[model samples]
Target: MYVVVLIVVVVVVVVVVVVVVVVVVVVVIVVHVVAAAVVVVVVVVVGVVVVVVVVVVVVVVVVVVVVVVVVVVLVVVVVVSAAAVVVLVVLVVVVVVVVVVVVVVVVLVVVVVVAAAAVSSPCDHASSSSSSSSSSSSSSSSSSFSSSSTSSSSFFLSFSFFFFFSSSLISPPFSSSSYQSVLIVVVVVVVVVVVVVVVVVVVVIVVVVVEVVVVVVVVVVAVVVLVVASVIVASVIVAAVVVVVVAVVVVVVVVVVVVVVVVVIVVLVVVVAVVVVVLVNFEAFNANYKIYALAF
Candidate 1:
């Protein structure tokens, strides 16, 4: 009976031990599987987050670069265009001033030469008359010579006075019969040249201005359109519209100002040229008239 009891106890103990070992092995296997699954899930989640962050960073970088490039290009183009306009305007002004100076110099030189010639001619006539008077021995011949000289001198003086008055009234002091035609021709040529130069300068300025304005407007509009297309925001679109309107207004104001300035310059140039011509002619006439009066 004791051996039977002992064997039964050993079998029970062994069975209990075997069952506990089996349970422990199963628990270990379950724990290992759960740990592996958790690790795989963590790895997958981390990869997805990393991919999303990289994509977002790349997109932001691309957008920023594109915007910077567009802005830089626009600014460069505008600067170049403005510089060209300024250079052209400066060159035109310099040319106009040079031409005017040259014309005035030529006119002054001509007046001096003509006045000198007129003064010398009167002196020669007086010397000749004095010589004729001196050579005469007979009183009768002397009387006749004196009378002829008096009549000739009187007629010449009257003619000169009439010419001077008429020239002042009709042609601003260039009505001497000998030189009237030449002086008129010179005046006409100078006026025509000035007009032609002014017209050419104005035309070039207008064309260049128009081209620049068109290019600027187009660029601005294109930029606005691109911005509006890229962004679907109402505030952005409104701002773009406002910018375009302002740009247009500014362009219009610039064009108007430029036109007014050009017109003023042309008018001033014409006035100065006329004044110079008048002054030169008047001085020449006064000098010639005084010389003739003294000679007679």
Candidate 2:
């Protein structure tokens, strides 16, 4: 009966676990679908924003173009109205006179600019022949030359309000109508020349610095090689000197040993000769005494 009850409890637990897993799987699928929907909504909203921005830019550009066209048309209409009124009242519109005067002035300045630019090329530092030409022009600026410079100066003086009164020493109004433009050109040329000179100087300095560095590197390498060579030569000379010193010491030691051996042999020979002489003298005395006794 106990084994039967255990089997029934295990079956019930297994069924509960399977039902919980199925519910969890269904919930996960629903969450995934909802997340996908939210992503699609966000993408649609971004596309709508981009389209709205494009529409606003187009509308603004059209409005600005329309405003500009309206302003231009209004100006034309007002100018035409003023000119018509003037023509009816005065028989000749003052606007036409002003336009003619401006056209004439512009044509004159254009002609002068062309003539001056063509005829007056700057002091040709490039040519060796220009100096003589410049000198002749200066010399001919004498008391009575009806040169263009003086005539143009007089003409400008009468037209302008200031040159008519100022003395030459005080100040002269520029004679050429293009005097301001000429001054600007001269200033620009001078600036360019100065810049060129400065750049050349900097380049020369950089080249010199590089050359100095190269020379220093070469000298350092030479010094290191010489030092190494000197070290090798000194070691060879020292080894030779040590070898010679050792040989001389060995020769001196051998000569001293031979002299000690000779001194020892001479001392031994002297001792043996003294001992033999004493023995011979003693034997002769004994024999003489014996013969004397027999004769008596």
Top lDDT: which candidate number? 1
List TM-scores for all candidates, in order.
0.44, 0.22
* lDDT tens readout by residue for model 1, 211-238: 4555456445544444344333432443
Which stretches of candidate 2 lie above 4 Å from their native place? 1-163, 167-177, 230-296
Candidate of highest TM-score: 1
How high is the CA lDDT of each candidate model?
0.49, 0.36
Task: Count residue pairs with overlapping backbones in model 2.
Answer: 0
* Model 2 lDDT per residue over 75-152, tens place: 543454344333323322232343344335434543454444433332122122433444466576764543544554
Clashes of each: 0, 0
Clash pairs detected, candidate 1: none
